[model samples]
Target: MGVKVTGTVAAGWETVRAEFEAVVAAQPHSPEAQLAVRHHGRTVVDLWAGEDTDGETLSGVFSITKGAAHLVVALLVQDGVLEPDRPVVSYWPEFTGHGKERLTVRDLLAHRSGLINTPEGFTIEELADDAFIAARLASAEPYWEPGTAYGYHAFVIGALTGEVVRRATGRSIREIYEERVRAPYGLDLYMGLPSEAQERWKPVLEALPTPAQLEIQAAAGPMPELLPVAFNWHTDPPMDLVAYANHPLVKAQGPASAGGVGTAAGIAGMYAAAIGEVDGRPALLKPETVAEFAKLHTPGLDRVVSEPDHFGLGFERQPAVGPEAFGHCGAAGANGFADPVTGIAYGYTRRRFGFPGGPAPENLPLTAAVLKVARASS
Candidate 1:
């Protein structure tokens, strides 16, 4: 059965609905998929399809959670609780180890810190234990000189950002998100999804690429050293899909870099709060903060993905789809971001796994569909 799509928004909802239905139909039996599109504070299209193995529940989105986590950092900056350009050592002096005293908060956010992966061969237990992982990070050396270049920090970025948030404000990243971003805006997202929500997590169903395909990807260009291989598993006994959905490393209060779990509606709600005042609630970022976030902080090929990626502050900008669009797209197929120019904030999460070498879908389809509607409405 196709995903039931229904929402109230401007005429753009029709375009969003058609595109979503088509995509869902093409990938029927996909574990779970959610698409939410908002324009100018109104949800134009909110839809969910398929089900968890247990049935009727939705899938857990992996990296799309990073978008929510990033927003928390932006909010902190807007409130003057965190300074982006300050030396990270000033906030967490221990992070200055291994000739890293020169690294700034902006370097970390831009993936220029050269700390791409955990050097300690982190296990699921270690990844989940904040103290253990953080200790390892402080003692670890950068893959390259800090601020000299850019590489996707992969898992390290989450831990680093979470630690900064922890030190600056005596609270967990999850707590700060709930108090400042989620609860105030009435969002249902969470970095650390409760045990009760475990029943709702739909596991990723798509198969990984073959070994030959992975080899091709590795040789394609500069790949992040920390990037996971085809069979990489975080759990001890190597539980694949289930572990990714329920593991502590994913569920802990790590900020926008990682550890976020929620639905499309939740993501759209959070971005809506940022783009406009939600239900009279205050904006998550001031105009200046948003402007700062939209400017290109890093523009070039990413060492991690070996693809051209742009970053501004904590958000991704000018993806291949549209120059005016700004938001983060995760590995696999998870997508979520907001565009202030057109007042479009979209969240699209899927459980199907698509690796780097396969005939993977492009990001432009979603953007093109949305922009068509946006242009017609104007």
Candidate 2:
């Protein structure tokens, strides 16, 4: 008979019972979610909830994939393949066009390259075509002076950094991630999720009290204009935003900033690997290298989100909405991050779509739940 397989952390299960329930209850139909926490290479919490499309339960995290993508770059740095301070134009010369010659790798990672929003008319599919997108960015002028100001690159960071990875290693970003990171640690995450694994994805239901509703809700509060129209980029018809997200172009192409798919378990495990070293295997980054990446480069009002977005090399720092976490969040409410201080890494994936600037704290609930587990474990 085949041996039964179980996760290593499932043994000493002291679940964050109430907090998890509160988070799950607050959201819409978020099927098949999982959360994992580890401290000093020891598992404290490994839990799963809900189901995927096939009724085989799982959770699908969205932009947290950016954090995973960042790890790939971290590995490159650790292996001496890439340097953060080098000019991006050195690797992809075409990037030197349009006043971007001076933009450094660190600028690209921190979303300060000034290539935000892809201009008005460019198709989202261009995001998948690195060369085409690079050319577009090359010819296009920066929305703001590169490195002088900050803006969330939104979708552009994925293409820009992914190109650097492709040019540096002569390997597809996905392949590099698989061989260097995922396979090494045995984590189930992907920049390009397989079609067969589509069965594992949950159908995200739209969250209630839409952005319009939130606007109304905020009218009663001190921050009435806090929910602005700028945040509603996902609603634009030209973008066909939802289709753009699920498109093969978006999936197969590595957008280190945004396009990624995986579970909370996978994401948390990957981050744990970053800090803990997987199964005694050598980490992709040295302790100092990780520390370097964690240094906050830009911390202030974001040009895109129009909020105080704290960014490290390629990770978001302690967001006002969550703990001292470092990871990326998605447009339609998905989040993944890790807290090295506490050895807590988490991924929360949900299918619910909502207008930006809504009442839903997006991934905050999951983050809060993870913090609870981490504190208990500590």
Worst 10-residue lDDT window for candidate 2 reads 223-232
CA lDDT of each prediction against the hidden true structure: 0.65, 0.63
Where's the lowest-lDDT run of ten residues in candidate 1?
A: 226-235
* Per-residue accuracy of model 2 over 327-353 as CA lDDT, tens digit each: 666555555666666776665554555
Write down the lDDT that model 2 would get.
0.63
Best by lDDT: 1
Residues 1-378, candidate 1: write the lDDT tens digits: 554544444553576667666776665245256677777777777766554422124455656655666777888888889999899989997886776888888888887887665433555555555555666777577777888877666555667777888899987667777788877776657777667776665555655566876798778776444454212333355435435555655665433444566777777777778877678766667777788877777778776666575677767775654555556665446677777777777776656565652113534576678767866676
Residue 268 lDDT (model 2)? 67
Using all chains and alpha carbons, the TM-scores for the candidates as numbered come to 0.85, 0.82
